[model samples]
Target: MIKLVIIGSGNVAQHLIQAFAKSKEIKVSQVFSRQKETIIPLLDSSKITTNFNDLIEADIYIIAVSDDAISKVSSQLPFENRLVVHTSGSVPIESLDNKNKRGIFYPLQTFTKGKDVDFSLIPICLESENDSDFDLLEKVAKTISNNVFKSNEKQRKALHISAVFVNNFVNEMYRIGNEICEENKVPFEILKPLILETVNKVMTLSPKEAQTGPAKRNDMQTIEAHLDFLSNKNHATIYKILTQSIQNNGKEL
Candidate 1:
């Protein structure tokens, strides 16, 4: 079994612990957290600790903390020349402290508390300085995910930015839709099926092919109506910008 140590107690860390703890091929040796109380919900109290010196020897040490905290946390690790990896999309592999074998284990998924994540569907992006370590990361990744990818720093960074546009920005659009629904005294649940269908359509169709609605048709009247309907200045501006983008993309076809 591949012995692994996980650091941090946030959403990514908790999800990693949940997934790895159940995997047959990987063993979670220990989890380090700043506060035992915080991580107690996800891990056994006995296996979770506040002291780094108390950390056991494991095959891989995954630092799942925030991007800004990665360097500081890795630098503080007491060990050296071990397989130390960070689960960050944008942070480069070189960001890890030079004392150890550096690698990245980025799971391209939006992790939220209380939401169940199907590890099999989430793509695990792996990168490492050493070829052997890359294989090691892949081995651990495959235990949880069928979709494992080997990506370089530039490619991973670009993927992260694309994730922001597709996941983060799209989620913001959903929020705006929900806001409009609430303002009109309609249940946001009414749009759930449509949202699900739109996502499903994109799975089989190119985004351009999947495109529909007034913007795609260049219905200026409908676009103006939407902008007017969004009384909030920021919301109106966002609608205008996205509508412009959609029509511009349509023009390309």
Candidate 2:
């Protein structure tokens, strides 16, 4: 059985703790959190430690902390030469302390506290210093997820940037849309079906091929109407930039 010791009680760490709890082939030996109470509800109190020195030796020590705290936390570990990995998308493997073997176990998904995610569907991006450690990470990843990938630092960096555009930036656009709806006293639910349809289209069709709306059609009248309708300067600016990008991309076709 692959034994893991997860350190941190944040969103990613808590979700991992819950997922590993259900795994028959992998065991979470212990969890280290600054506040033991944060972990107690997720794990047995006996298995949660407030002190780093109390960390038990496990096959892998997963440091699921903030990007800035990774190096500091790894440096504080009482043991070395053991497999240590972090669950960060943008942070590189070298951000880890040299006291231990470094690797990355980034889960490419946005996590929120108290929200349940199907761990089996989340893609786990793995990278290690050597083949042996990578094999171990992959084994652990496959235990809870069917979508596992071996990603190098460069590829991982690019994937992370793409995720920000697709997930983060897209969400911001939704917020802007919601704001416009509210200003006009319209129910935001009115856009739900259109949103769902747009998402479904991208599954089988490329985003460029799936594109629609005034921007894609180059309808200057409709585009100008939208710009005039948007009273928020920031919103208008963003709309103009995105419209220009879509038109530019369409030209390439």
Candidate 3:
């Protein structure tokens, strides 16, 4: 069995704990956090430690802490022989000291505490300092996900940027739409089907091919009407930029 110690107690930590618990090859030997309150009710009665030196011996230590805390927490670890990994997408694995084996086990999916995660469907990005470490990382990743990729630090960084665009920015757009609906007395639920369909279409069609709107057709009249409707400065700016982009791409409305 692969003994694993998890560090952190946030959303990502909760998701990983449940996923690892379901795996037959991996066993969570301990959980480490600075505050006991942060980890209570989420972690089982396995070895829990607040002192970094008191952390139990494990073959692998998975750091699921905040992006800002990774390097600091990693530098304080007691063991040098065990493999250490972080789950941050933007943070490079090399930030950790090179004295021991270091790797990244990033899951390319948003995590919410108490929310169910379909681990089999999520893609796992695996990277390591050397071939042996990479092999071990891949083995551990394959247990949780069928879609695993050997991504280096640079590629992972680029992928993270894309995620911010496709996930974070897209969610912001949805929020703007909801706000607009509320201001106009339009029920936001009216757009739910359209939103779902838009995402579903992209699964079978390229985003450019799935493009359908007045902007895609270069319908200046409709575009102008939309701008007029969106009086909010930020929303209007976003609309104008996207309209110009769609027209530039020559995508049919």
Candidate 4:
């Protein structure tokens, strides 16, 4: 079995601990959380540590900390020259201290606390300095996920930016829709099917091809109606900007 040590107790770390727990090929030999209580429910108390000095030997040390803390955490590792990887989508692998072999094991998905995710479907993006380290990282990734890609730093950054558009920005649109529904006393659930259809269409069709809306059709009448309906100035501004972008084929205004 491949021994692994996870550092951190955040959403990604907790989710990874759960995913790896179900994999027979990989063992979470240890987990480091400053407050041991945070990760106590995920693993045996014997396997949890509060100090970097208490970390046991493992084939790989996975740093699942915040992006800003990655460099600081890696620098504090008591050992040198072991495989160290972070679970950041945008942060480059070079952020890791040079004391150990550095790599990235970014899972390209949104993680939320108290939600269970199927790791098998989530895309795992791996990058490493050497071929051997990459092989090992790939092996561990495959145990939990079927979709794995070898991504370089530039490609990973681009993927992350695209993710922000698709996941983050798209969610913001959903929030705005929900707000509008609530203000008008409409059931937000009524739009769930339409939302599903929108997502499903994009699966098989290009986003441009799947586009269908007043904005896409250049229906200024409906567009103006929507703007006039939105009482929130911020919401109206956003609606106008997005409508113009769609009509202009996403040209910068």
Ranking by lDDT: 4, 2, 1, 3
Best by lDDT: 4
- Regions more than 4 Å wrong, model 1: 250-253
Clash pairs for candidate 3: none
Q: What is the C-alpha lDDT profile of model 3 across 1-253, one tens digit per residue?
A: 8889899888888788888878999988889877767666766655678889888888788999999999988999877867999999999887776656899999999998678989999999998888988888898888889999999888999999999988999999999999999999999999999999999999999998999999877789988898888789999999999888878895465
Give the per-residue lDDT of model 2 (tens digit) for 130-179.
Answer: 99999999999999999999999889999999999999999998998999
Off by over 4 Å in 4: 250-253
lDDT for residue 159 in candidate 4, whole number 0-100: 96
Off by over 4 Å in 3: 250-253
Worst 10 residues of 1 by lDDT: 244-253
For model 2, the superposed segments whose C-alpha errors exceed 4 Å read 250-253
Backbone collision count in every prediction? 0, 0, 0, 0
Q: Which is the better candidate, 1 or 3, if ranked by lDDT?
A: 1
Report lDDT per candidate: 0.92, 0.93, 0.88, 0.95
Provide the lowest-lDDT 10-residue window in model 2.
244-253
Over the stretch 91-192, how does candidate 1's per-residue lDDT look in tens digits? 988889999999999999999989999998899999999799999999999999999999999999999999999999999999989988999999999999
Tell me which residue pairs clash in candidate 2: none
User: lDDT of candidate 3?
Assistant: 0.88
| Cα error, candidate 1, residue 73 (Å) | 0.4
